[model samples]
Target: MKSKVIQKIKLTKDPISNFDLVIQAQKGVDAEMAFEISETLLMPDEDLSLILHLSTKTLKNYQKSEKSLNPIASEQVLKLNELRKKGEQVFGSVEAFNNWLKKPAIGLDDAIPYQFLQTSGGMDLVMEELDSIAYGDFS
Candidate 1:
């Protein structure tokens, strides 16, 4: 009889599966991953602080210590990654999506989408708006 060693592999592909995201969230998101997300999204520390509900001082400490974000923050980070993908798909490019985020949208009550990235409910509303645009229901 041969003994088999089963190794768990973390998913590193784009658009990670929901199950994998849940697991990753539970384990917490590392500083490197947070940095990657910020870089990819062109988000400044001030914006990130709002999303994570953490003070700028704490965020700096986390960076200095190479800490992992808590589960709630980790989950928010993962969701933001998904939102980035969806935004890119809808607008045809990251640049276009980012431009859209900066401008006020009529459907979003003339509010800039970037301002809504702070909370889960606001993120969902943005996602809904994206879906509406993608589906040609711009009204």
Candidate 2:
């Protein structure tokens, strides 16, 4: 039984990169993995729920389910993974990236970047800001 449990845990991929996980997430990753990915991204349950447009009870249900996320939810998770991965890469660490997300940014018109990850257009704006940061454009 223990070995079976271990094997079940091992069934999940150990992704080489966050983007790799994003690919998995887009294709309907297991619900448990969604929680794990949220942790990996340093996202609070509230943030994740907002990003997913899901209720807290829904998230709790997903946590308890043995099934994978539906296509819509999976795509949301993918978007989140993209943002978290890009943030970490750009800021060089999760700590710096999360800090930047919380702080107001001039590029975002003084809005917190992390809150924008809840939607695609907002995510695009945040991505553009990160791109500018990466290229030293800042404009």
Candidate 3:
């Protein structure tokens, strides 16, 4: 197994609004930014590739070349970042949120939330679950 060595880059000191993320997504997400998001969410290349509809080899190639992903993938990256923030808020910590992600959620038809992250629709469902949790609605 290849070890991941994350070299963190400064994203922004100020909070990024949804409008800013939309603009950034339109501009494209570069390899470094994607990697940063992966690190933030504790996701390995394999998982991120699945969510981005890319292969691990391609993700490595992009990292090697510092290539920027197209708009759609870029948007996915930003959405993941946003989800990470919301999850932390809902779960009280990133570690807790990550743990929750790996388990089956009754609200999601007993599917692991991590698996749901692979598609936009599934991501929306995961987000809704988080919202429900935040609002104290466990059912």
Name the runs in model 3 displaced over 4 angstroms.
1-19
Task: Evaluate all candidate structures by whole-model CA lDDT and list the values in order.
Answer: 0.76, 0.69, 0.76
Q: If ranked by TM-score, best first, what sequence of candidates would result?
A: 3, 1, 2
| Alpha-carbon RMSD to native, per candidate | 5.6, 5.4, 5.7
- Residue clash pairs of candidate 3: none
> With candidate 1 superimposed using the best TM-score fit, by how many Å does residue 33's alpha carbon deviate from the native?
1.7
Q: Write the number of the candidate with greater TM-score, choosing between 1 and 2.
A: 1
The global Cα lDDT (0 to 1) of model 1 is: 0.76
Off by over 4 Å in 2: 1-26
Clashing pairs in 1: none
Per-residue lDDT of candidate 2, residues 1-139 (tens digit):
4324323432433313546445554556555656766887678888778877887678888778666676667766655656666777788886787788888898988888877888877877987898899888552
TM-score, candidate 2, is: 0.74
Q: Is candidate 2 or candidate 3 better by lDDT?
A: 3
